[model samples]
Target: MEPLVQDGEAVAIEQEAPGDVAARDMLLDRAMGPRWRKKTSQKIRQGRRPADGLAFVARSADGGLAATVRLWNIEAGIDPFGRPVPALLLGPLAIDPALKGCGVGAALMRHAIAEAARLGHGAVLLVGDAPYYERFGFTCAKTGAIALPGPVERERFLAVELVEGWLDGAAGMVVPTGRYVTKSRVRATAIAA
Candidate 1:
């Protein structure tokens, strides 16, 4: 995909690659710090990849990683009527400290949301600053009744319905519904090694 030009800079949005893993993690560390590992979002992402075709990074004109965003498959638990509501969890949208307010994060959000709509996804839930995400159409109006498995500032839990009414009456705990990577788990034998 061609990079989007904002403020005379080319910010390319592309699928995150296997080769980008180390750099991605490092950028995340720099952006989020060690405390990132202790968040409720970390628990949901601990052993899974982003939802298929939903992981993306913003690269600077020189090809350095500038920002990252990931979406994960999750259940908004069961709705009020007891039907399961499939949804995507968007989070940890980390932008390089140096690139904050450079429009990289906004570009990533637009691209991801557009892609998700194209892929027929319904709703997206996230824990984020309402003022920041509200620009992308996320609102607490849809998330008022939803909860996370761990402690979170209730006001920060927000949702956006890619499909109208997707979040209507959908309320419950959000849980990881994607493939959990077992390869990263250290077995007892490996622990002794």
Candidate 2:
């Protein structure tokens, strides 16, 4: 991916390198607070890696991390017609507090979605502010029947079809396809060792 120019400087958007994990988690904690760890979105993303080519970061002109976003594989459960829907989930999009209104965050969103589509993904789902995400073509119209594994603001559930009509009848519980290991299970394993 090419770096985007912002204010006469280059804002590079690139695949998140392994070394970026600590910085990325710190950035998200600052932007989203400690409660961010307990959200329904976090539950689904708990032990998962972002889909191939879908985890990205934006570095500012000074080479400081500026923003980040990731897309994960999820199952929209079985619809009324008994068809299972496979989709991508977007979340934890965080921008540096100092550069909140800068276009970096928006650019990340655009790039992430476009990359997902380019990779042949059919649909994307997210729990976010409808007003803010509507600009990206995410709407609650097709998400009325979808529920997150944990409690979430119903109104914040939204979806966008990467392929035309991909979300038409996607209804069910939003479940993570990733292997989720509970914290207690980890403790139990440690005790048995």
> Each model's TM-score, in the order given?
0.91, 0.88
RMSD of each: 3.4, 4.4
lDDT string, candidate 1, 1-193, tens digits: 8888867878899998766777877888899887887899778877776899999999889988889999999988777789989999997899999878888899899999999999999999898899999999988888777778799998898889999998888877888988865664424213432
Q: Residue 186's C-alpha lDDT in candidate 2?
A: 49
Worst 10 contiguous positions by lDDT, candidate 2: 184-193
Clashing residue pairs in candidate 2 are none
True-vs-predicted CA distance for residue 158, candidate 1, Å: 0.6
**Model 2 residue 74 lDDT?**
90
Off by over 4 Å in 2: 179-193
How accurate locally is residue 159 in candidate 1, as Cα lDDT from 0 to 100? 86
Q: How would you encode candidate 2's per-residue C-alpha lDDT over 1-193 as one tens digit per residue?
A: 6788876768899889866777887888788887887998998887666777789999987877889999999987675688888899998899988778778889999999999999999899999998889999998888887889888887898889999887777778888875454676545433543
Clashes of each: 0, 0
lDDT of candidates 1 onward, in order: 0.85, 0.84
lDDT of 1 at 81: 85
Which candidate has the highest TM-score of all? 1
